[model samples]
Target: MVSVYKKILFASICIFALSCKSKKEEATKQNTTQQATLVDVIIAGTQQLSNTIEANGNVVANESLEIHPEVSGRLTYLNVPDGASVSAGTILAKINDADLQAQLSKSKSQLSLAEKTEERLRKLLAVNGINQADYDAALNSVNNIKADIQLLKAQIDKTVVKAPFAGVLGLRMVSPGAYITPQTILATLQETNKVKIDFTVPAIYADLIKRGATVSIINNNEPKRTAVIVATETEINTTTRNLKVRALLGGVPINPGAFVKVLIDAGKQINSIVIPTNAIIPDATSKKLIVVKNGKGTFVNVETGLRTSSGVEITKGIAVGDSVVVTGVLFVKPNAPVKIKSVKNLTELTKEQ
Candidate 1:
């Protein structure tokens, strides 16, 4: 009975040891499989961001107008030189002036007959063969006919349409023999050679926007072009709190209505740390960034400054030489170990695309 009891106790101890060892091995494997999350990062450094204020802008033709007739009539002759240059005072179109011309002719014949009758009445009055009232009526008829002729001439002039200024014509909207009214648009004219940059800036910069002050223009990430401040709206917008500004472009003409960026020199360049805009982690209370420190991702709060087409300025929280996680921001957890796949510079991290 003692020998049987010893064997049973030994088997029970062996089973218990095996069970404990298996659990330990399983836990060890789980820990090893739970590796660090891989991510790409950018090294923060002081960058020379343009010490300028940036704003959205559009290319505007210096002079633009819709071609409309002063008088309404059937267009007997239409000469819309589409996409062609025209000089001031050039006749663009003509209305049917035949009726006005015929009226003018009839008035001239009536004036001639009235003048003859007035002369005969004057002669008769000289001899006391007619009353003074009769001579006066004859004289009044001649004056009335002359005035009618003058009125007809003025109406004929209104039937013609002329270019107001030298400009390039746009597509024609009306065809010949079309009975047009004052509201009808014949075409559009624009001075394409001269273009102005139209942009709005914050009202706080109102005092800085002066007439004839030079500013910079950038398009498609190309080199900067210079433009001079030409004019500004008198009052600040009540709704937007922005001041409308127009600058004259001095270089090659940009297509009207094309989007461009305006850069105004705001005193000096800002040499501060900047990071990719995507790397920012927006929080409810403050902005944050995933920073890699000692092989771990730590969320750090940061204050931002002037933002440009390239990157955002980091005014506070992030330091120079810090590793800021650019990619895999959502997958990273606070105080969790992360794998650094590669480090990039400010330019390589983000582009204006």
Candidate 2:
């Protein structure tokens, strides 16, 4: 009976040891399986980022001329119709110059007679037959006659109206046979091949913007067109604390005084890390993101720069070729084990591991 009791105790000990070892093995297996769960990661690369400023403005013609009569007379000839396309020096209107033309012809005849008299007097003086005073008087008379002819010619030229530049003419304010003063508006001419966009930017951005800076213009009635800065005001407005900028847009059809939106690039390009917008998680106090390091998920706070429609620029808290959790990031915790199944979504690299 003593030997039988000893045998039973040994059997009980062996069974207890086996049960404890099994429990330990089961716990180890559960931990390994939990660590093997897969998570999606995006490998991001560096990209050149451009900063831009958006502002609203209005479109103006590159050149505009207001046609006004230079002389006071009866408008006799109205040659150009309203909204007529004209080239430089195209005649638009003419004032009554019948009297002026007669006067000009008379002055030219007198000038010819004076020139003949002056020549005869000079020959007489050379032969010592005429007095010096007589020759001097003849020369003065010839010069005076020439002056009168020039005055008459100038007055005649003023009667015929001509276009100062090549452009489209506006409505004619005066009609034929209407008496027009110097203040009379004959028409308006505006060049429309290239348009200028005028806008004001904050004073802080004045230094960043300069002549030749590229801009994008979107007109209310036309499609978007690319332009460049043609001019910039050197002085900033004191009341508004803004600097004025003008951009010239060519090859695009736009009208004067039309409303437009201008977008200008503000700064130099910088290499920065960018990620999809959905990948970033905003915490209560700061912005955070999950990165896969050494097959483990790590949480990091990041500083962002420009925000675009597709992604946000990561200025800090990340580097190139870093695997970031783009999907299922909210479900991950710090120091969590993660399996990287792909890295192609974040960059141009092909999937290998």
lDDT of 1 by residue, 99-166 (tens): 88988989898999999999999999999999999999999999999989888888898889888888
Best by lDDT: 1
TM-score of each model, paired residue for residue = 0.79, 0.62
- In model 2, the runs with Cα more than 4 Å from the true position are 1-50, 267-353
Clashing pairs in 1: none
TM-score, cand. 2: 0.62
Instruction: Please identify model 1 stretches exceeding 4 Å from their true place.
Output: 1-35, 111-147, 219-224, 235-241, 283-286, 293-295, 350-353
lDDT of 2: 0.83
Alpha-carbon local distance difference test for all models: 0.89, 0.83
- Candidate 2 residue-wise lDDT, 95-171, digit = tens: 99999899988988988999999999999999999999999999999999888888988999999899888888888
